[model samples]
Target chain A: MREINVAAITSCVRQMCMDANYHLSPDMQARLFEAAETEQSPLGRQILEKLKENLEIAAADQIPICQDTGMAVVFVEVGQEVHLTGGDVSSAIQEGVRRGYQDGYLRKSIVRDPLTRVNTGDNTPAVIHYTIVPGEQVRITVAPKGFGSENKSRLFMLVPADGVDGVKKAVLQTVREAGPNACPPMAVGVGIGGNFEKCACLAKQALLIPTDQQSEDPQIRKLEQELLAEINKTGIGPAGLGGTVTALALHVKTYPTHIAGLPVAVNICCHVNRHETMVL
Target chain B: MDCRISTPFTKEKAAELHIGDMVYLTGTIYTARDAAHKRMMEAIRQGRPLPFDLHNSIIYYMGPTPARDGRPIGSAGPTTAGRMDAYAPTLLDLGETGMIGKGRRNEAVRQAVIRNGAVYFAAIGGAGALLSKAITSAEVVAYEDLGTEAVRKLTVQEFPVIVVMDSKGNDLYEIAASKYCTE
Candidate 1:
């Protein structure tokens, strides 16, 4: 068995949080550039150009791309043969978020309680998802999710009769409602199948897929491409002021489910979809 | 329409703006978001003085990151204004003439804007780092404990924003969307 200290995870999480906030992923940036070049609306093109400029400023100055530096959402994949030591993995990851937000000057956006609504002061208690996999290594991904888009995410539990068209209708409806609110052009993360909570997680995890890359599954790839085209036809455009590119890409993940139910979850992300991954 | 304007906007000054006008604002403004707005309203209920002037003043719905060394502010972008919808109409009634934010406002906010002849500007959302470049200086004026959500007095120069909803009730969102929506 490979022994790993939780401290290493902490350090990795810390850097990932800061790095993700400061830099837009290259593939996503390329999408924005492509959108700028192809967008027909004058204002939409202008907005896309400004977004690119915003990314450059964030990277060069090492500041967050957006003030809503977002709540840190982490995904951990641990090899089944690995033994964790030195500290608890959960606490270690939380500590990383706290230190990263504090040291990096990223905004501390978490609240102590949903009811009382007091700031936690340090961004902490990262929403963590874990999986046990094959190798002896631990992989951690940090995606700072901004609430503007997060607030617009939706989950629909459809009866089996709803089928694929139902899923499409649900997604399109969610995106249409999100409109200017989700900060279009958006990257839609869709999860189909699985149980309720699992489907929600899948939607979020789908967002981690490289936007430029397409699903290898031919059917899924076709659906993704079709969705992207239909969404852009929305004319919600760059900042939702109207254009041909409402969304940059759609990341869809599907799994097996119960015979009676069809569950679909859409986790919407704004143009500033910030995420970073590290392995140790 | 590319327009240049300064703050401390009166009803008449604000009325000059129309939906679709791309404006660059230079002058003083205040910042407040969810927590600070609640506190301000609570203070008003308690018959206490507000932290800053409200007359003809513009409030930016934002919560910014901490500034790094030698900088006056950090990445400062508009937050979703809809979150502040509950407080916006009341603030507009109190003579606050302008609000800078992103996203559509509630019907009440739109009504308030027209009733008071106030203007609502849309700052490019997700462009915080670029937006910060326009803010020359920032100082927390109230609710210090609110951290990023504190009310800040800011001096901005050539701050770019678009007139999303104007005093006359023209909404750029509807106007612009109709121009391009294929679906």
Candidate 2:
């Protein structure tokens, strides 16, 4: 078995956090450009132009793209053949988050306690998810999630008989309810057919998929394309002022569920959907 | 139409604004979000003086990231306004005439705006990096312990916004959404 140093993990996480906040991924930038070109409303087009300019400024100045730099979320795919050395894996990740937010001059948005509501000073205790795989490599993805869209996420347990139409209705409803609050021209992540909690997790995970990529499953790919068209038809537009480019992309991820249930989750992400991945 | 306005916005000036008009605001504005709003409401109830006078003042619902060295503030942009709906009418009654935020205000908040001759402006959400260039200066005036959520006094220059809700209760969100709604 190959051993990976926890210190190395810390440093990797730290840099990924900083980079993710500073740079708008090229896929997201390209999609925004396409959205702007095709958007119907003049005001919507102007807003999209400004958004593009803002990202350019962020990249040039090495500043964050948005004020809410987001809570650090770490997704790990660890190989069963690899052993972690030097420190506990979770603490290493937290330290990385703490240093990243602190050194990067990003916002420290986490609270020490949900009830008492004291700022944690350094953004730490990152939400971490781990899955073990067969190889000797460990993959880590850092996604700093801002609360604006996070507050808009929803989960529903649908009766299996309701089927695809039910999924469409639920996704549309969530986007409508989000309106401008979640920040329009959103990237919608839909997770279907899992248990309730798993579905929600999968929905969030789907958001990590790059905007340029579509699901390999033909049916799911078609659904993603259809949902994108229907959402834009709402004219919620960029900044929800009104336009034809309401959603950048709709990512759908699915897993097998029990015979009686089809749990669905919608995790809405703003256009600044930031994530970075590294393998070691 | 584009209009340039100064803050401590008066009833007459606010009435001149209609839904969907683009506005660029200059002069002093205060920043407050969930925590600061809650505290301001409580202070008003207790009859204590506010950190800043409320008359005709405009408040921006924002919690900006901390500044880098030599910067007044980091990417500052409007947060969701609906979270403040509970405390907004009380502020309106206290003579606060304008608010800057993103998203749809509740019906009650819109009514309060009409009743008090106030206006609500929408700054583009998730455009913090772009918006920060307009803030000339920022300083915490109250609730300093709240960190980013503290009430900050800001000097702004040509900060862009759209008049989303006017003194007469016209709402851009409703108008725009309905305008584009497909049959």
Candidate 3:
């Protein structure tokens, strides 16, 4: 069995959080540049240009690309053969987040209670998802999710008869409503065929698939292309000032579900779409 | 058309601006987000004075990251103005003249813009690092406990924005879509 100290995880998480916030992933950058070149609206093109410039500034200055450095959403895969030592794994993860936010100078956006509304101050207790797999390594993906688009995510439960068209309509409606509020030139993560919670997780996972990639499944890939084309047709454009490119990518992930139900989840992400991964 | 303007957003200045105008604004503006706005509203309900007078001042709906390297602020950009829709009209009614944010405003805010001769401008969303260069200085004015959500007074130079809702009640978001829309 491979033995790993929880402290290593803590240090790794801290670095990932800071790194993800400061730099836009290369694939996302490539897509944004492609959008800037192709966008037809003078205003949309200008907005895209400014966004690209912002990305440059963040990287050079080593600062967050956006003020909402976002609440950290962590996805961890642990090998069953690995042994975790030296303190609770959960607390170690939270400690990593606290230090990252405090030291990296990222914004602390979490609140202690939903209604009473007190600031958590350190951006702690990340929304963590874990899976146990074979092998002896631990892989972690740190996605800092901004609320501008997170607030727009939705889950729908449909009868099996509703099928693909129903899913299309739901996604389009969500995109239309999101409009400027979501920060245009967006990435859409979709989950299909799972139950309520599973679908939401699927949707969130879809975002981690490099923004420029296509799904391996032919059927899901076709739907992704179709949705991207239709969404850009809405003329939401860059910054929703109206143009031809509203969404940069649409990704879909699916899992088996109950015979009677078809559940769909749409998790929208702004162009920033910050994430970083580490394996140890 | 590109227009250069300074603060206090006086009557003559408001009249000179229109929807769809690209504005480079300078001088003083105050920052507040959802929590700070709520506190301002609560203070009003208790018949107390606001931390800063709304009269002729522009309010930016923003919360910034903690500044490093002796900089005045960090990655300061506009948040969703629609989230502040509830408090905007009241703040307008109290003599606010200009607002900066991203996203669509509700009808009440549109009417308030017309009623109070105010203007709303959309700063490019997700362009926080670029936007911060324009903010020459920043200092917290109220609600220090709110951290990034604290009310701050910012001095800006050539801050870029597009006039979305004008004093004449024209909303660029309402019309910009049709001009560049695809079938």
Candidate 4:
């Protein structure tokens, strides 16, 4: 069994949080450049150019790209043969978040209680999802999810009879409502065929897929292309100021659901979707 | 063409702005978001003096990240204005003339703008780092305990924003979307 120190995980998580906030992933940056080329509205095109420059400044200056900085959402894939040592996994992750936000000067947005609503001071208790896999290497992904677009996410439960068309309608409706509110030229993450919670999780996980990457499944790839084309055609454009390119990409992840139900979840990520991953 | 405007905007100056006009705001503006708004409203209910005077002032709905070493402020950008819609008309009634934020405001906010001769501006939402370049200085004027949500008095120079809603209730969101959105 390969033994790994929890300190290593903490250090990895800490750096990932800071890095994810400071830099826009290369794939996302390239896709935004591509969107700029096709955007019809002069204003929208200008906004895209400004976004790219802002990202560049953030990276060069070693500062956050956006003020929201977002809540840390970490995904951990642990190998079945590996064993955790040194400290408890959950606390270590939280420690990493605390140091990262505090040291890196990222915003601390978490509230201790939903009702009373007091800032936790340090962005902590990261939303963590874990899975066990076949090999010995552990993969950790840190995606700082800002609530602006997250607030616009939606989940729909449809009867089995409402198939692909239903999913399309639901996604389009959500995007329509989002308009400029969710920050256009957005990335759409669609999760299909799972139950309520599973579908929601799948939708978020789907966002981790690089904007330039396509699904391996031929059918899924076709659906992603169709959705991307249709969404861009909406002309919500960049910053929702009206343009030819509203969405840079669409990612779809599917899982089997019960015979009676079809669940679809759409997670909207703004142009500043920030995520970074490390394998240890 | 871009217009240069300063704070404590007069009714005439407010009326001069129209939907789609670009602006470079230079002067003093206050910052407040959800928490600070609630506190300000509560203070009003308690018959206490507000931390800052409301007359003819413009408020930017934002909660910026903490400043780094030597910088006066950090990445500061507008937050979703819809969340502040509930508290906006009250401030407008108090003679607050302008608001800076992103996203569409509700019917009430639109009507308040027209009725009170106020205007709303849209700062590019995700362009916080770029926007911060225009903010020359920042100081927490009230509710410092609110951390990033504190009410800050920011001195900005050539701060870029677009007129999203004018005093006459011409809304750029509605007009622009209708004009440009395709099937």
Q: DockQ, per-model, please?
A: 0.85, 0.75, 0.81, 0.75
Query: What ranges in model 3 sit over 4 Å off?
Result: none
lDDT of 1 by residue, B1-183 (tens): 998887778888898888878999999999999999999999888989998889999999999999999998999999889999999998999989999999988899999998999999999999999999999999998999999999999999999999999998788877676677776
CA deviation > 4 Å runs, candidate 4:
none
The digit string of per-residue lDDT tens for model 4 on A145-251 reads 98889999999998888888898899999988898888777888999987999999999989999987889999989989988888877777777777888888789
For residue B112, what is the lDDT in candidate 1?
96
Q: What is the TM-score of each candidate against the true structure?
A: 0.99, 0.98, 0.99, 0.99
Error of 1 at B111 (Å): 0.9
Candidate 2 lDDT over B1-183, as tens digits, reads 899998779999999999889999999999999889988888888988898998999999999887889989888878899999999999999899999999988989988998999999999888898899999999999999888899999999999999999999998888786667673
> In terms of TM-score, how similar is model 2 to the real structure?
0.98
Judged by whole-model lDDT over C-alpha atoms, candidate 3 comes out at: 0.92
Tens-digit lDDT track of model 2 for A1-280 = 9999999999999999999998978898899999889988999999999999889878877678888899899999999999999979999999999999888888888888998888888988789999999999999999999888899889989999989999999999999999899888899999998798899999999998989899999999999998888998897889888878889988999999999998999999899899999999
Per-candidate Cα lDDT values, in order, are: 0.92, 0.91, 0.92, 0.90
Q: lDDT score, residue A47, model 3?
A: 95
lDDT score, candidate 4, position B114: 89
TM-scores, chain B, all models: 0.98, 0.98, 0.98, 0.97
With a 3 Å backbone cut-off (N, CA, C), the pairs that clash in candidate 3 are none
| CAPRI-style docking class of model 2 based on DockQ | medium
Q: Return whichever of 1 and 3 wins on DockQ.
A: 1
